[model samples]
Target: MCSLCGVLGGRGHWTDTSSHPEAFTHVEQPTRRRERQERTRLVNTVLDHYGLSLSDWAGSSYVLKTKTGQTALVENLTELWANAEQLTKHDFDPLDEALIDSLAAKAAR
Candidate 1:
């Protein structure tokens, strides 16, 4: 596996997914205390930066797809947040093509 998969796999070890199938805990950082809290924070940032919200997406659980959806959201939101750091950019805009493919798949509607 490559870096993305490696990261995903590591995150997998952090949570209990037996009941919820794709459940995961993000790589804990000083900034993030819990996985869902981090995701909630992520949702707010992405919504604010891109002027979009998870309310725009069709599914209830984007995390059902991957452990990195928050970051994927951030990456996706990059074009809208040109100068923000990896975290505070408030962009889930899928900047890299590979990241787009692995995460949100071009976001066409």
Candidate 2:
């Protein structure tokens, strides 16, 4: 599908739900937006290792881009990782020793 269609047809991912699923109503829009921002920040910490960055796209999707200008609009974290690998030509192994070590170091600091 084209980027525009994908964006227009976006659906909420399971991870995007709040602890109180019913809180997904319009009244909770602000809270949901904040959550997405936090998620983007945390994801960026991992993407940094691969020269990629992610930003919340209007609180609906993510904008993933490489240091060299390649980009992808992903609907969720699962798509984010797959597209990240494609853009960087590198595997994004969560269990990668270096990645775990890096995250550990960050937590320690």
Q: Global lDDT of each model? A: 0.36, 0.79
What number of clashing residue pairs does each candidate have, in the order they appear?
8, 0
Error of 2 at 44 (Å): 0.6
Q: How close is candidate 2 to the true structure, as a TM-score?
A: 0.79
lDDT for model 1, please. Answer: 0.36
Off by over 4 Å in 2: 1-11, 19-30
Candidate 1 colliding pairs: 73-92, 75-94, 76-92, 76-93, 76-94, 77-91, 77-92, 77-93
Best by TM-score: 2
TM-score of each: 0.23, 0.79
